[model samples]
Target: MAKAYWIATYRSIADPDALAAYAKVSGPAIAAAGGRVLVRGTPAQVYEAGLNERTVVIEFDSVDAARAAHDSEAYQHALSLLGEGAVRDIRIVEGAEG
Candidate 1:
């Protein structure tokens, strides 16, 4: 199966404490679900569209694994902490095979 990438871009953060709470749980949850965080942080620069934002990319073994990680109980707990805390766009996509 092709590898998968979980990409999340945060448009705005409304509650820093809540995001901190989410991070506490999310890392362990992602790791437990066989996910590896490849990139995470604010972009160093933006070339167009004024789209500067914090982003995260996680790698998973397969598309199904990425979906499973998002649906898993531990991640659900993390989501609960982050409810309404930020505006973000998230996607899970299969990576190109080399």
Candidate 2:
């Protein structure tokens, strides 16, 4: 099965506390579901036309695994913090075989 990759680009974080809240909820959720965070932070440089200021990348075993993680109760619990705090864009893509 192809691996699943999550790429998120975001900006305008008005409340760092919201990120803190997500860290508390989503960190354990990702760990519990075997997801790994490949990268999380500002990029050294972004050349894309619509690129956001911050970026995050995550990897899961397969598309199903990624879907499961997104649909999980724990992640939903984490999402409660998103409103009014920041704007985000998330994408899921299939990775190539090694």
Candidate 3:
């Protein structure tokens, strides 16, 4: 099966402290679920129509694994800590076979 990627792009951050708190918990939760963070940060440069937003990409063994990680109790608690802290767009996509 193709690897899966969890991509999250933060459109806006209203509370940096809240985001930090969520990250503190979510990081461990994701690691426990077998996710490898591939990239995380604001883009170095923006192309046409691309906003300078914070983006994170995490790799998982498969789509099901990624979904499970997102739905896990630990992640849910992290989400609660991040409530209304920021606006983000998240997606899970299967990687192309080499």
Candidate 4:
């Protein structure tokens, strides 16, 4: 099975308290969903296109695993915290096979 990855950028963080609260509540939820956060708060030096403030990358065993994470109750609950916490752009991409 091909590994799956998620690339996301957070925008419109109007409330830092909400972000912190959500992170506190949701951080572990992501781990429970069988996803690994590869990158978080890494500096992005974009050569082209616009840049976003916060970036996150997650990896899963396969596309199915990635979907499972999103569909899981833990991740779903975590997602709920995004409404007032932050706006995000999320994309799922398949990794190249070895």
Candidate 5:
């Protein structure tokens, strides 16, 4: 099966401190589920109607693993800390095989 990718685009950050807390646990939660962060930062350029936002990309062994990571207790705890802290758009996609 093709690898899965998790993409999170932060539209707005209301509480940096809370997000920082979320970041702490989120990394380990993802790693535990065999996910690796590929990119994380503000986009250098935007075209069309793209909103300026912080973006993060994570790769997982499979879509099920990606979903599991998001639904795990560790991640859920992290998300609780992030509640109302930021507006984000997140997606999971299967990567094309070469």
Candidate 6:
């Protein structure tokens, strides 16, 4: 099966502290679920129509694993801590095979 990737792009951050709290818990939860964080940061440069915002990418064994990690109890708690802290777009995509 192709590897899966969880991509999150933050459109806006209203509360940095809240987002920080979420990250603390979410990181461990994702690691426990076998996710490897591939990228986490704002873009170094923005192209056309691209916003210079925070983006995160995580690799998982498969799509199912990524979904499970997102729905896990620990992640849910982290989401609660991040309630309305920021606006983000998140997606889980299957990687292309070579």
Give me the candidate number with maximum lDDT.
Answer: 3
Per-residue lDDT of 6-91 in model 2, one digit per residue for the tens?
88777678788997888788878977887899999887876858554788888999888888888899898898866567878788
Sort order, lDDT high to low: 3, 6, 1, 5, 2, 4
The lDDT values for all models are 0.96, 0.83, 0.98, 0.79, 0.94, 0.98
User: lDDT per residue, candidate 4, 32-68, as tens digits?
Assistant: 7778999999455765666756888899888888888
- For candidate 6, the 10 contiguous residues with the lowest summed lDDT are 44-53
lDDT of 1 by residue, 1-98 (tens): 89999999999999999999999999999999999999999989888685889999999999999999999999999999999999999999999999
- In order of appearance, the predictions have TM-scores of 0.96, 0.89, 0.98, 0.86, 0.96, 0.97
Highest TM-score against the true fold, candidate: 3
Candidate 5: residue 72 lDDT (0-100): 93
After superposition of all CA atoms, the RMSD between model 1 and the true structure is 0.9
Worst 10 residues of 5 by lDDT: 43-52
Better of 4 and 6 by lDDT: 6
Per model, how many backbone clashes are there?
0, 0, 0, 0, 0, 0
Q: List the pairs of residues colliding in candidate 4.
A: none
Per-residue lDDT of 2 in model 1: 93
lDDT of 4: 0.79
Residue lDDT tens for model 6, 5-61: 999999999999999999999999999999999999999999999999899999999
Which residue pairs collide, candidate 2? Answer: none
Q: Which stretches of candidate 4 lie over 4 Å from their true place?
A: 42-44
Instruction: Name the lDDT of candidate 2.
Output: 0.83
